[model samples]
Target: MENVSTRRSGQALLVWGLLVVAANLRASLTGVGPLLDQVQADLGLVPAVAGLLNTLPLLTFAALSPLVPRLAARWGAERLLGGALMVLTLGIALRWVPVAAGLFTGTVLIGAGIAVGNVLLPSLIKRDFPTRVGMLTSAYATVMGGVAAVASGVAVPISEVAPGGWYTALGCWVLFALVAVLLWLPQMRAPRRAVQAVRGHRLPWGSGLAWAVTAFMGLQSLGFYVVVTWLPRFLQDNGTSAATAGWLLFLFQAVAVLTSLAVPGVMRRAGDQRVLAAICSAVMFLGYLGLLVAPGAAPLWSVVLGLGGGACLVLALAFIGLRAQDANVAGALSAMAQSIGYLLAAAGPVVFGLLHTVSAGWRVPIVVMCAAAAGQTIVALAAGGGTVRPATGEVPDRVPAPR
Candidate 1:
């Protein structure tokens, strides 16, 4: 009974600790876009360079993702996560240096830290809570999306009162990393054990299902990053108030939280998730269509976009664990999907802008995205069905398997 009690206590800690870690994943990055104007003025950066603050991280995510499984194999996930939080903290603080070089350096560090969290997290879930993937994925995703929206919403407000202006707003995220580091410290103390799993899993490059998953992940990320990058400016360009634009973005994220929560339950009950995938993609297409065809209904469109984008994000993340037979396979699959996904995502905003410039209006880009979202429906159908091909040398799937 005492051992059982101790086990329950540790499980509870892991649950809430994962939630806390998820909370930090996107808040820091999301807050920066809303405050980009201030940074641009303060640092004398051109618009081209100003955009790097966001894109640089995605680039880093792309570069660093493939190495996380190997790193986790050597250092163990808990210790690696702890080290990442420290890196995140240091990176967030480095932004206080107030130079363009400082911003680039800090952003790169932040991306590197987040990249590890992004890849290893699903592996941790697969290892620790094999029986509860859907539930836990939904919970953490809800937390991540909800906190990210809040960060974006509060960013302008925080800058208004933070005496250091945008610097304080940007630097405020450091507190979250600090807290996560403290919360995760207990887990890292177990290093007397051997290094974690995640070896013997190849990249799954030959698996068509794996490729489908990677494409789904990338397409969804591209849509999301592009929207996050430009939706505010798009709304403002059409004469909406700044506060309203921010709130609309918040509403988009808030709606996503609901879908993110609901999709996991559906995933568990359904034979396959193709229907959910199709419906979500359709909703996002309509949202993008509504924005282009009738900018006046931005709030309604934001809700639609959020409803779809949120679920797609969760599916993309959850599939990493759900599809894999074990933590080792999950880690490798995640590394592949996200490395390519963020590479695709990293190009979205730049391409959106180029289309806008070449066609001399946002309409061309919206049209392109509408087509892309339509393509997503097809990819979703493929990725959402059929058996997940396990990475090479993976053990058969297990239930309630502890790492």
Candidate 2:
């Protein structure tokens, strides 16, 4: 029993440390959005193709996510995460090079680096913070969301003030990656214990529940990236200045940070997340309605949307951790969800752009997102029922027939 207590204390440290590393994951991507137009104009990219720039990262995430668990199992999670951070840092630093190929390669590497981190984090929480999975997960996710907001919000202004142009603004995130690498360094060198996960497992990812979780996570993420990548431009098209649109996007992301912090705590206590998911989708619906009908008051509606969307993001991640019974299952589920989810998310900006081009307005895109959100609400309800999976380490002797 005394040994058990000591192990718990060590797990706590690891969980917190992993959270700090995860917090740095999204800043590099979101930080560049406000400066994308500047990049497009300066680099001679077409506006339509500019949307591809945002979607490219998601595509890489989808393609790369499936490999993280295999790498983690063979090399160990700490080593993989630490190595990915180095790759991520190098990728960020390289984005400033003069060649267009550098931009594309750097973006892919960044996505790949983040993909590795994304797959491992939930598994870490499942392994380390089993009891407080929801709260710890929420805390890290909140920090992730907040840092991303700050990066996106300040990118333009910081670029104007910095000497290296927008490259300076984007490159600033390399410091965070360095910090993650520093913190992660100790873990890599530490001796493995019986308690620490040495390998991740393979699961039949095509199962019904897995697919449901994947689609729910993916579709919701699709809506989110769409808004994050294009909402500023949407506002600009609707007559707002670029700076104001960026701030409004900032406001949207800010509210999401708050919900990411609070919603998981509440849902964990509530002991279910279906209602919360539905409510989140509804909030997104209202935000879309406001944006579609009254473009001027986007600040107000953005808060509502961000709140719900952030909640969805946190809950989606929490569910991934909770639904799995062990680090391996968590890692597998995380990979499957992200593989499918990021694919869904990768479609957002490009599809939204295509839809906008056809309709010559934001109305059609808003309508499509609303429909997707409503469908997600139903999936969340099924996922929240606490029946899709049993507790960790208790896989059924025989697989039950699919629903």
Candidate 3:
């Protein structure tokens, strides 16, 4: 009875922590897209150099991800999470401090904070809510996407009205971090052994299917970040007003908020993720087509892309749940996948911009993204087999029964 009560209490804390952390994930990531032009103009950033503002978070996520699990292992997950949130609060606060260097410096700090949160949350979910991983992951992703919608949608209007201008607009998100700080304090205070778990323990990364899962996640993220960083500019190039472009980005995040809830449940039940993967990639392809063929006529298509992309992101996380047979394995695999995968994904926006610089158009980059989608579909088929091979070398799909 005592164990049961303690387990329930831990679960409650886990859910609350997930919600608070999820709300902070995307604010720093997506908040600036709407205000990039304003920042560039105010700070006199070179157009090409301004692109790094969007790229910095991805770079930070990639570079910092491999360190997260080790840090969690050494310090305990709750303390690490709380400490990361402190970094996030400090970072978000710096953005409003009246210097361009502070702006860039703060953005880097925020990205590093978020990267730690990103890697740790999956381990927490795996450790605490093992059976409810899908549910918690879906809820967290939904909350994340919804907050992103609010941030992207409101950032420009907030900037227009704030006396300190875009700096104040960007600073508003620090309050979200502060909320996370308050909620996370108890967890930090909780006994360390209560939450600590062994790290660097997981399934061997030797399986073809495991590698496929990693690549699918990496490729899908590459395409998603490319769109996130460049889509508003893409719309502006086609003569859409800045506010409308921001709202279109909002539409993307908004649709993701819904799909993050719906698609994970569907994939959980359907037992075959291949079809869902195909549908997701298709939606993304068509969304880009809408941008190319008729920018204004069907904004809904872009929303669909958001739905699909958000679902893909959630499902990638879900793969860790569905694929792992235990928490230690899940955390280890999650670290491997995210550490290498984010590094690959980090290249997306920078490469997309370089392509545009050379081709002087979006068409070539669109082709590159489409090819990535095709690759995702193939890997999705392989990983969707719903097989979990433990560290033992047994092959589940093609093995005869043990004699």
TM-score list, all predictions: 0.95, 0.91, 0.90
| Stretches of candidate 2 exceeding 4 Å from the true structure | 1-12, 193-201, 387-403
* TM-score, predicted candidate 1 vs. hidden true structure: 0.95
Best by lDDT: 1
* Cα RMSD of predicted structure 3: 4.2
Q: Write the per-residue lDDT of candidate 3 for residues 331-371, one digit (tens) a residue.
A: 55666677668888878888888999899998888788877
- Candidate with the larger TM-score of 1 and 2: 1
lDDT of 1 by residue, 1-403 (tens): 9999999999899888888999989988999998898899988889889989989999999999998878877777888888998898899999867777777888999999899889878878887888787778889989998999899888888899978888888888998889998898898896533425455446788878878889989999999999988898899988999888888888888999988988877887877778888888888899899989998888788888998899999988877877776777788889999999999999999999899889988899999899989988888888876545555555644544321
Candidate 3 TM-score to native: 0.90
Angstrom error at residue 158, model 3:
1.6
Q: What is residue 338's positional error in candidate 1, in angstroms?
A: 0.5
Off by over 4 Å in 1: 191-197, 393-403
List the global CA lDDT of all models: 0.85, 0.78, 0.76
Total clashing pairs for each candidate: 0, 2, 0
| Model 2's TM-score against the true structure | 0.91
